[model samples]
Target: MVHKFAFENPHLKAEAVSAVVMTDLAQQYKVMSTPHLVLNGTRAVKGRLSEETLLAAILVEAG
Candidate 1:
């Protein structure tokens, strides 16, 4: 099963989307596979990532 989660902080925020239902969005963002994480619409890292790796990716785009 798929699930979506969300959270926010003074400095950062995040939400989850199910690509299966949001096909158009998934395509628009070039999310061709599962476990894809897009940060700030400026960059995306495909596949599952470790906490550190995800943070790094987000930082790159948050800049």
Candidate 2:
């Protein structure tokens, strides 16, 4: 979804990392589940979220 969102939005950038390989990062963000999303380096949402919900999160974090 992050990839799709970034593809659709020109100004947005997104990246996917392997929790296994990026253990340090995963620990930094305290990732406890798959499909975890970190917005603006502070806000985060874990578990699957709809596109609209994800977009709203992005907007709120951007603000």
Candidate 3:
């Protein structure tokens, strides 16, 4: 999920928000240790999965 400190504290300066934004974006796009699947905006799953896992991910994302 994109967890920006500015979301909680709107007064945060652009520099601080940028720091968090860049970090989150990097993690989402990074090659190493990346999650196998992202469910919803927060949930993550790694490694091989079954139909149940797929269903859960779809449901979470749909919500």
Best by the TM-score measure: 2
- Clash number for each model: 0, 0, 0
Question: Residue 33 of model 3: what lDDT?
Answer: 45
Q: What would the per-residue lDDT of candidate 2 be over residues 3-57, giving only the tens digit for each residue?
A: 8889988989999999889999999999988988888788889988998998888
The true-versus-predicted C-alpha distance at residue 28 of model 2, in Å, is 0.4
> Each model's TM-score, in the order given?
0.73, 0.89, 0.37
- The positional error of residue 49 in candidate 2, measured at the CA in angstroms, is 0.4
Work out candidate 2's RMSD over C-alphas: 1.0
Where does candidate 3 have its weakest 10-residue lDDT segment? 11-20
Off by over 4 Å in 1: 1-8
Instruction: Residues 13-50, candidate 3: write the lDDT tens digits.
Output: 21212324467754664424433444443665666667
The weakest ten consecutive residues by lDDT in model 1 span: 1-10
Local accuracy of candidate 1 as per-residue lDDT tens digits, 1-63: 112122433566566789999999988998878788777775777876777777666667767
Descending-lDDT candidate ranking: 2, 1, 3
> TM-score of predicted model 3?
0.37
Better of 1 and 3 by TM-score: 1
> Candidates' lDDT values, in order?
0.68, 0.88, 0.47
Relative to the unseen true structure, what is the C-alpha lDDT of residue 21 in candidate 1, on a scale of 0 to 100?
A: 90
Q: State how far residue 59 of model 1 sits from its true place (Å).
A: 1.9
